[model samples]
Target: MSSGAMSQKMTCDKSQDRHEEKVQSSCKQSPPGHMTDLGKEEVADNGRPEKKCVEEVQSLWTTEASGSVKLRIDELCPQEPITVHQMFINCVQKYGHLPALASKRKEKWEKITFSEYYRCCRMAAKSFLKLGLERFHSVAILGFNSEEWFFSAVGAVFAGGLSTGIYTTNSPEACHHVAKDSRANIIVIENQKQLDKILLIKDNLPHLKAIVQYSGSLKKKLPNLYSWEEFMRLGLDIPDKTLDDIISSQKANQCCVLIYTSGTTGAPKGVMLSHDNITWTARHASRAGDMQPAEIKQETIVSYLPLSHIAAQIYDLWTGIQWGELVYFAQPDALKGTLVNTLREATPSSHMGVPRVWEKMMEKIKLEVSRCAYLKKKLVTWAMSVSLEANLKYSKDEEKPFLFNLANSLVLEKLRAELGFSGCQKFFSGAAPIGSDTFEFFLGLNIHLYEAYGMSESSGPHFMSGPYTYRMESCGKVVPGCRCKIANVDADGSGEVCLWGRDVFMGYLNMKDKTVEAFDEEGWLCSGDLGKTDEDGFLYITGRIKELIITAGGENVPPVPIEDAVKRELPFISNAMLIGDKRKFLSMLLTIKCVINVETMEPTDDLSPEAVKFCQQLGSQATKVSDITGGKDKLLNQAIQDGIARVNSKATSNAQRIQKWIVLGKDFSVSGGELGPTMKLRRAAVLKMYHNEVETFYRELKK
Candidate 1:
């Protein structure tokens, strides 16, 4: 059947609503205590409260057995998907006066309300029709976050066209790969830099038609490129309602967004997410998060991450629209400046971040505390301890000790305010493994960061951690309805993680064989990650099965988890590669975090030549400062030596130790070719980069 026809045939029965546990407050009258299933003497086994089962009005939410679990996403949209055009319509109708998006233009913050946002998207769609951007035609967006970028994306979606976004940080080759692969006809690029990258390979993309540029200023000289203003002016004459009607009529199963894999295995694979796919995922996740519509007094969010990734789309755009929230897009380069000010000003109740961002925030916290008096540090530490304990207990649905909470308010409130997270109600961490210590550290500060795990193919979060029942190292319980099992276990029973759920993506776009391989004969997607579940059913992701090492001693070891542990303790460390595929013992190569001193404008000579050479020349003026000594030369020398010593001390033994390592003069990044878009190490690529060093290590061992 034709895709559109197939989508039209797909129908959702209201009886099959996946999220059945939701108690519409409008229909039910109950006290706040009647929310949670706890403290019910006459409660039914099915969790229905006999005496109006009480729900404790928690500031945050988690999907517990007693609470409402989100409905399966597939059930929500059924055959018809939730299109991007629909998101614009929903936001306009529900939150037209609210700021839909905020982006910087010419060093000033620019905002568009939900109504204006819908108008812009509609106009852009109309303009695209005028320009003949039609079904299945690819439009590639390349640049930092901006209102123009967003409008163009929505416009393309409204016109029944596929839209693909590239990270502005990506190199020309990466851009070329996506542009050519997507068969892009029209490209929206940010400024001359991104335009230049596309222009560099413009000749190579045979399908390329037009280059649309948006930025600080448009250069009149660029060839085959239309200026942002000029492009919008053409569409401005088109009525908004015309585009809206066209979008509303579009089928759900139609392609809404095209996301490319980070290419950890090889070249990027395009994953087509329909309006149904994204909308349902967002709906269920919001439900799982217990994001009640009433709780959204005024949703404010910071959208600074790269929009090319799924996390940014699901959380920033999709959730923002569904909940009638305001999204603040920061200037690409001024993330820190914008972040602190935005958080303080907006005081968003919900925020999501990768582990690294939180780590850096903690580092900043430490740096700030170093300047405070010793007594202040002691008080802060004591307060953090109390607050964290309260948070941990609170997560488990246990009441916080009254004394501890009192102590927390008296002491940690100041610390929380200093961190500019005083009003922050909920935070989520995903995309990578976060250490338990780091998790606990935030909880201690009364910042409940709900760490979850999922892949791009899974449509984002599958397992979630919240203020309850979290095992320090385990990712979290499988989000309701998602089932995970281990495959190919040894004597100890560790194996590859396989998952089956509605949140799973339809499949890689146009890659049937590849999709088949990802799933089993029974149709479960093999997550490619190595993990294990506890007796309590909590999921603990150990490592990647693909990156496992089998030592000569017949011991199979997963390296990523071990490497992750060591790296967490050493903040200066950037990347750690575990070596010992068929060797006597395990060893690793550690690279320190590289930083550029804002004042000096050069790589700080913070470590000794030997250690610096070992750590890949990770010199930063952004040191712990407390660890530095005397002057720049002295501090650099000591910092280098200290960074090496820190990593050396964190290793467990010969198997888990860094025997000999070299820090590179550079950092691993997507643009730099050392890291994947998902931030996973390109192992073979890194090994290739350090071939000589590997040879030296083997030779030294033999000697």
Candidate 2:
């Protein structure tokens, strides 16, 4: 699309874009500070932009946005020749003997040095070359997080192929969609299970040339299927110089990874992130959670989040590779079990989790507290109160009471140890908006929970909280080399979060139409999500612009916070969505989180009102999550009502509170088409699926 056509295409969007609409608004628009050449804009700027990393946003947000002459973080910007392959080779030279990777084998963590990691990476790349993979082509990796997964991903990049990953939870049809769309030449899988999925759908994927299993041998051994070791052996004859030649020729603008978005609105779009994106992100992300110099050198991180998620790609993979940080592969199947144990053993210097992960951890802590002795419970309650007070005071930069110091050592320190957070100086939470209460709770325990903001389109970690500038509510100020602006705005300065930077993605793979739609003529990518910048340029993501619930009174209320509040009220709720766009009052659709640990495959403790009622329904026998979620129990129904009431109590007005709610008969899941790959709620899809329920809610209101 030409620049003129792009302008016409984004006409509707510009009106809604607060940054564009209120160009002349006086919001203390300060010029950005000079920075190192690492983050300088590469593309020519036709029209004058706000600054290199500064941007126009809500007037309310920037009325006092300037804070003590903020300067760009030059130290965290990417250096020259920023490519994944180049970066990996550079690390090998700098940290040759440093432990680069660790994967589980039976019961122990097997380690790999930086040089060894590069050698394996080169072997994988050489194998891809042997398979006839080339530049502009793609590779598909299907599996959970593993060392093999990393090797394959880097191998694809080293071989000059655009590498993309498929969520392990994706159905065969979904897998086929991505594989076919990407036109991947080689597809890498973990075991028989993932291989079987490809076999079921490979017939439709003519571009798929070979299948490489990362682990687990198949006796069948189809013509195109090869063991990972066999594939690696194919490149054994290839010299290290050949791999170096490819890495040296690699360009910064080459599409390195195709990260698929969560697809909350529609089908998943493969975001084409270039080598520049990865390196820039890797540099800034390493410094996003700002730790001590010593801590950075010896940083250990437990990698358990799905590597497919952009959060994991940055937090564990890319940053680890770039900074020579030690990464321990935690089992994806053990969020609370093997992962917790591994974190304890590793004592990782850094930790990161999505909202769900942290929420589950908080829930577990509460559950454990409930089971404590009376004396223990009393002491814990007292300590938590004192600690929460101290944390809140500390957040506001106020002097903490001396008692807080005592409480931190006496209770919080031990609590951190038990939860395997003893060495975590800064724990990151992102990929979803976390509740302030949850943040407070984490802070209460003396954990530095840094909320961040990024997407596959931005590589990852574009904006994040850090030790230097901590904010519980906002994600953080614009990252060192990135520009952030609240685009489509209203009278109050809330609208789309437009982004542009070195880390911004190339475009959606094989989707030129979407590519044009993603960015404006000025080169700013209009992020569909709604947010606002604080007085100090910190970002506070409110919700998706499309998901905003505007009531009949014309009041725009973000559903995310309300829905999050509702979910927190009930331990059983897996998801919640507020519905009131042009309606008189808000209503919610509630879905249950199974009373079993899906990851650990263990039944949750038979506590909670839902479990009690479920047991009663089953003639007082112990009941499973499937039973309670499928059937309607009186006690469970009442509990849902009480939970809604609790959420509504926080609403400032009746219009804002949930007036009606229905506990859905089933959970929203990826396979069910009600949730996205990351389990993010597909609000529109859910409303359409439950059209009758929603109508009944409004129909009864009319009657």
Candidate 3:
């Protein structure tokens, strides 16, 4: 949904009687627990060089349930901190002078040291106090991933309040919905653009107390709106001891952040996460990520992913604080273009991307390869085959056959560098399922890409590809502190992948009924995702239980994996929807990629001469990207036949084959309501929106 569609301005400007949770800290702090999880390296009182925190005398006993447990990430680290603020304080004191946060500004990288970051965080917290926000209240963070954003969130934490992030792409109405539900008292916005959104629905948010913006251009227009500087300036009068008192009184179980779910089926729910949730998760994540102790302070990572999601919290915010790692923030709106450039320039030690990022990168590379000269194309193809063959062997725990290393050094290594993974030691994917074909492409490039499985309920990923054991086709082993189990198995062994872990979220904030439904009686988080575990302990997802397509013969078919396979066969097919539930035969709905004029930036509803010739060879007329969906256009239908045939050939029965199919008039888009806010397909919504078109396919099948 576009901001314009919802509203041109933000909503809210009211006061409410807010309840504050104040902890009276009478008990003295323990004689400093064994190790602080806040990325602490003990400083010697006698000038002996510092070490990776203080080593304890406790026995390093291994757990009997090895399968459920993972390698200990940090034994010295505490299991939980009274508050995330305390965790941050421990880290800031240990690495006070180290670079904590950095961002690219005007083509230059700017940084703030841990000390400066702490100061800013303190000031930001004081600003909230200056706004008269009650403790335990929420401060909605509305902005791109930036230094100020992180500072503001941490500041809220210091003031003993919950920090909630709203997606930068959320429409104004969605923003209003979140604000209203979260009961956000103050919103720290990025600029006038976002400020305008709050203005649109301000009247509806009865609890919203103030609007604070980083930009000062609109200071004169809205008298109540305060500039970033002005807001922090208000905090100068707030004694530093005030924030210290708040942080000192924070409890471990208190809600520290409210992370909203993707809401594919309905309205997004606020997932309440406590301080322990993040500190515990980040500790395990620190080890699972395989950050060598030597590289803990030296490593640099880019923060380009959506900050609203749980993944960014673990890797960018919480993890950065835990390890004292340098974080580079990508420019807003220019993330795609500059991310690649910055990767090439900065050469980060670790990198992460979702499926869409890899998918688009592959499309760009393939397009360029198509235009390459015959000899160059042939050489590139042969080189990739060699790497792919080697990767296949390596994945099976076999050594590279012959001249494999030579092939990598000759063609693959340079290519990896070009795509910005040369220096990247840890490249992983999570959030959603990545296509097998896409995974292989990265493997072919010698870029060992791995997949992980988790949700907002798990505090990001409690399971990921560890350094020692990893499989290309499965989500890796359970991270430490998380016990994984497959429940209610079928004949095929597929079942709901369930988990119980310290890293799991506290629960939904306000939805009592939904909270009960999220987990089973045993407290295992019922993921709702259907999958099976292999003998090697690797987990392979079949599909969503709610999304399973039961054919007329009663055979269940997982559509996503099949759709991904079809795309692997034909790159032109943008998306495929397998329609066979309760039907005599299987069918599909596909939407091709959008084609636009390079210069004009308008939809080119005319196919290129070369493109037309390519489709002509497949017995289909040329069609533009815009014409492939939204209506009945058979011009490109035949062109996708080979791809469909490839999928059908793999099917076990006739009911699983694509007996009929059609191209949609548009992409499965978030703004179009075809996909959910998180970009996951809304099956029910999609079907309802195209009921007439979908029914026609079945009617034709009847004939």
Candidate 4:
């Protein structure tokens, strides 16, 4: 189909999105009788017919409206030499009047329309070209999420310079590694803090030619440094038509970005994604997720997540451009206010989040519920349950039971308004392992938070929760058109997840042997993540293969399940490491949250045994995690054993409980360069750092 045909079809689908209307209508009908079967136990146990019940609804979500619309390759002919420049042309022509990028001024969010966004990016790109930046040259972008940071990246891309994105949270040493490794010629940074990080390593990186500072407040004397405004001024000499011609000469296979992996181990490696890689990934994602152009023009996205990450890059920026979506950037400190206000002003139809964001949202709800009157909380809970049941039954068969709808209107509608999610139609959560209970509860609120699963290597999405037909535990069926397989499984069937698809990265830049090793003889890229597919072919990730702990008896144990259990039982505990290779039993090193002293109000050194002792005395708190390892001494043996008897009760014969354990006071932090930005455990480095504590666990036992 032609682009015009695709546009018309998408416009038609926008006319058909009546989910909220259906929900409002359902609120007026009677309750479904079948719902009794779904929530009977909760009603019976609570001795209240109106009590809220938590249940999972299985519904199928499809993009039949948008999916049928197709675009031939001819529709997307490159008008520019590079992807970023081409995107600017797209924004100017298609979505000129729509807000394209946003930033904050005086604690208020300000928006720049698509045309304005294009103009800024073009000016920056032209400036780079004037600076003699050439194809394959590397430019590093460092700082908070800002308009300057984004436009500079577009500028680099327009000049045929590959951008190396570095998280502002990273240390000077980390910055040095990325700069030296990518051989960046120019560094675009936000402010003093970011510039300082670069300056600290400037002597270490001799290839670095210039430091482009965005904040105009930098008045200090520095060598080869340019201000953001000064850089844009240089572009004034370059004509718009000349820059357009430069953009048109760009090739799809040309390296556009040098995205560093959130390194689970060692130094971060640059993953080279070509212009084609990004465009195709965005296209595939848009198609699979039904990210329609009309939705872009209508939806408002609040961008606060680190722009350095691929998730932010693909979902927030690239996808937004394809559809003419408005982008909103929030100040780092005012994320909560910005997110809530943006949601209110934009009343966004679509939103994407991570596990941490969802957990905080739930915590906010709990906090609000705490402040509400008892009767109001009970009414809200009851209404939500009824609404969920009605939705489930109605979805199964479009028959609305009248009684249920009346109960829903009384309570559920109010609950949604309180959550500030009343207008949100579809939500997506990805990047971390989310609790199944939390996942189901959101579904009960009439909001489907599809928990997607994938890594940077997979171009950001491999599996997703079908917006309509979602399974609580499983990440949605392998995203449409992607093929995957399990490589070398153990007896219970879990194994390394391998994938081969159009979306997969070409390979780690300049690491030929490592790239070859990642793929099998047949070319399937081994995902290093351990997982299993249910009989229905739904993929469920358990843990990383390297993070899997094996006992002396060779019984493989995925620590994530156990660690998740430990953390659930103790939210104050930030990090936990289970260690036991050839030892007598599995033991864990717990890191408890540090508390401040009354006198100084300063955190008491937590890296001491006293903190562990204090946490142990707090009591044996426990919460059950599902579909995990089942053993005889399960309940009693599960909680970290304070003594021998408790330890004996928790472990099965072969997995016999933790013999000894120690608690560390300090929590792992990414800013400290201890944990990766993604929060994955760096076991070897962790073990090496705490070698004494680990040794004490076994050494004390030997005594």
Using TM-score, give the best candidate's number: 3
lDDT of 3 at 513: 81
lDDT per residue, candidate 2, 1-703, as tens digits?
A: 3332233224313222342222213212422122233345232111223122222232111011011111122444434434675566545545657887777766666777776666666667888888878666778999978878888888888887877889887789888888887888999998888888999999899888899987666768798788875786676556555655666566665567888876688788888776767866776655656732222366888888878778898778888876778888877576545678888888888898888778778777877887889999888878888988777767646767889878888887899998788877778888887876678778778776788888887888778788876776888888776777777677766788998676777667667678778878777778789888878898888788778888999987888888878766665566788899989888888766555546533335334444454446545443444444433455666767787888788887778888888767666656578867665778888889999989987896688
lDDT of 4 at 424: 65
TM-score of 4: 0.77
Residue 482 Cα positional deviation in candidate 4, in Å, after optimal superposition: 2.3
RMSD (CA, angstroms), candidate 4? 14.7
lDDT of 3 at 554: 88
Which runs of model 4 end up more than 4 angstroms from their true locations?
1-88, 295-297, 334-338, 380-419, 569-574, 592-653, 672-674, 700-703
True-structure lDDT of candidate 1: 0.63
Where model 2 places Cα greater than 4 Å from the true spot, the runs are 1-81, 239-242, 291-296, 396-399, 551-555, 568-574, 582-585, 592-594, 597-657, 670-673, 700-703
State the lDDT of candidate 1 residue by residue for 1-703, as single tens digits. Answer: 3332122112111211221122222113432211131111121112212221122232111211112112232432232234455544444444666777765444555666665666566556666776667567678899877667777787788776777888766779988988887778789998887877887899999878788876646666665577765566565455545654565555444456778887777888877665655665665565565454423477567777778888877877777766667777766653444476666655566788887678757766765665679998888777787777677656445678886778677877776765556766667888888766667778777776776788877777777775553566667777665678889876656788887665666566667677778878766778989878879888877788778888777677778766666665554566678787788766667654544343332334343222333334444443332233223345455554565467567655546544554445555655456677656688878888877767766886688
Tally clashes: model 4.
Answer: 20
Q: For model 3, how does the per-residue alpha-carbon lDDT over 44-119 read when each residue is reduced to its tens digit?
A: 1222111222122231111110101121233544243434655565555456568877666555666667656666
Candidate 1's TM-score reads: 0.78
Per-residue accuracy of model 4 over 1-703 as CA lDDT, tens digit each = 3332233223322322242233224333433111112112110111112211111222111111111111112322212112444444444454666777766555555666665566667677777877777567778899877777777777788776777789877879888888887778888988887898888889888778788887646768687788775676666667655665566556554567777887766667777666655765665565456555643336666677777888777778777766677777666543344466656555556677777667656655655665679998887677667756776556533665776677656766566665556666668877787865456566566666776777777767777665544665777767555677988888878889987554566566666566677778766768889989888778889888777777878876677776666665555455667787666668887654453343332334432232243334554222221111122223333443533344345554658455565555455655444566665567777888888878876776677
Give the best candidate by lDDT.
2
Q: Using TM-score, rank the candidates from best to worst.
A: 3, 2, 1, 4
How does residue 689 of candidate 4 score in lDDT?
86
C-alpha lDDT values of all predictions = 0.63, 0.71, 0.69, 0.62
- Summing lDDT over every window of 10 consecutive residues in candidate 4, give the lowest-scoring window: 60-69
TM-score of each: 0.78, 0.83, 0.85, 0.77
How many residue pairs of model 1 clash at the backbone? 26
